[model samples]
Structure formats: C-alpha cells, structure tokens
Target: MRHATQLARISSILSATLPPELAGHVWFAGCDGPSAVILTDSPNWVVLIRFQQAQLLEALSHILEVPTCTQIIVRVVPEGLPNGYLTQR
Candidate 1:
C-alpha cells in the first residue's frame, strides 16, 4: 500500500500544473502504492480517476487523456465545492 506521504507528494505535483480554475476543482490525486486516483469536480463534470502503477503519470502526460479516461467516474456532489477555473486548453 502507498503511504500518505507518497499521496501528498503526488497531489502537490498535480496541483501545481492545474489551470487556475481547476486549482480547487481537483480535490486530491496521488499514488496508492502501485495505483493512483484523482478527484475533480466541475460544474459540468465531477470526475474520479484511477490508474494502475505508473499509468497515472503516463496518462497525465497528455492532458486530454486524463479527462478522456475510460474508467472515469462522474456524479453530482450535492451543494458542490468551490468554483475553480479550468481554462479551455
């Protein structure tokens, strides 16, 4: 299993590259041992991401790949979270 430190590290790195709007939209992202997951909320899309081992990094390499993931999950979050901007890249 992945430690909290590893998850924190990955989350930090992921947060840095996010667009200003997407800053707070992404709740968390990190490696859970050899796997990883990312949580993102948007007005139009509430996305949950999961990957095996290094695949997360590989998918992240192509920004669109992340959003286009076949395993992505989406659902409404009641009142919703803060509004973060995700510039149309």
Candidate 2:
C-alpha cells in the first residue's frame, strides 16, 4: 500500500512534467533499481517519451532527491484493462 501510494505520487508529479499533449497518455509504472518504469497506451507515445527521457529523469531525480534515478523504461499497455491485469498474467 505504501509503495502504491508512492508510485501514485510519482505518477502525479511526472504527469505534470509531461507536455500537455502527452499528459494523460503516460503514467508511472514502477521503479527497477535506478530505472523508472513508465507505461503508455501507444507505441507513438513511447517515442515521444523517449524524446523527453532526459527531462523525465531530471524530474524524477528531483522528486526523489536521488541522482540514482538514471533511466526511464517505457512500455506499452493497452488501455481499459483492469489494474494488475499484467501482473496477474
């Protein structure tokens, strides 16, 4: 529950950092070591997120107050699935 709250907080911060055009389409997934996982509904958004990788990392590091936030991993998850569906599978 704590981790989920933290992820949600991070998601809110990162969502605000995104371009207005891309805001709702991208979301925080989870963190793997120094990498921040991100999820999007489309492949096109993956490329767009990559374009903002550096900025995203910067924002993440600032929020977490850790320079170790070094990588952003973006994955495509189809929209409208129930939460936790991916993990269940």
Candidate 3:
C-alpha cells in the first residue's frame, strides 16, 4: 500500500500531465474523507473517470510520470495513523 503522501505525489503528476483540453476542463476537487471528487467542465470526457478509481490510476500513469497534484484526500486510519499504514498492517 502507498502512503497518502505518495498518493499526493501521484495525484500531482496526474493533474499536471493531463492533456491541455483535459487540464482546462478537469479540476480535482474536495477531499471528502477517503474519496475525493474530481470536478470537470467537460462532463463527457470526465464521465470516463468520474467514479472509477482504477481509471484514475490508469490516467495518471499514462499522462504524468511524476507530476504535482492540485488537491488530494488523505484518509485517516482508526488507530490514529495514516490509512496507508493501517492497510499495510
């Protein structure tokens, strides 16, 4: 499992690498707990990504090799540790 910090890095990379059209149309939004919402001006293209976590990762990997994200959600673990650690444990 990857840490939120690492995920943040991944998100950043993903955000930056998005195609110009996609970049302008898409904006990553609020971190509501473990899930964060992605806002889009072009709903059509974004529809492919809106609720698919796997798609998000796929898009990120294809677009940005190492980009900084605009926003991210860091889910907290019940044991007062980061969720990443909890998952690993």
Provide C-alpha RMSD values for all models, in order.
Answer: 9.2, 4.4, 11.9
The total of clashing pairs for model 1 equals 5
- List the candidates ranked by lDDT, beginning with the highest: 2, 3, 1
Each candidate: what lDDT? 0.42, 0.78, 0.44
Give the alpha carbon lDDT tens digit for every residue of 1-89 in model 1.
Answer: 24444444445555556555554545434334433345555444332233231344554545433533333332334464323322211
User: After superposing candidate 2, which stretches have Cα over 4 Å from the reference?
Assistant: 79-89
Show where candidate 3 strays beyond 4 Å: 1-14, 50-89
Number of the top lDDT candidate: 2
At residue 77, candidate 2 shows an lDDT of 77
Query: How well is each residue in 4-88 modelled by candidate 3, as lDDT tens digits?
Result: 5555454455556565455433344434544555544343655444434454545654554432333333232223432442232
lDDT winner between 2 and 3, please give it.
Answer: 2
- How high is the lDDT of residue 20 in model 2? 91
What stretches of model 1 exceed 4 Å from their correct place?
28-36, 41-89
Collision count for each candidate, in order: 5, 0, 5
For 4-85, candidate 2 gives per-residue lDDT tens digits of 6667677778889999989777777777898888888888788999899999999988988877768889888776533643
Q: Model 3 — TM-score against the truth?
A: 0.37
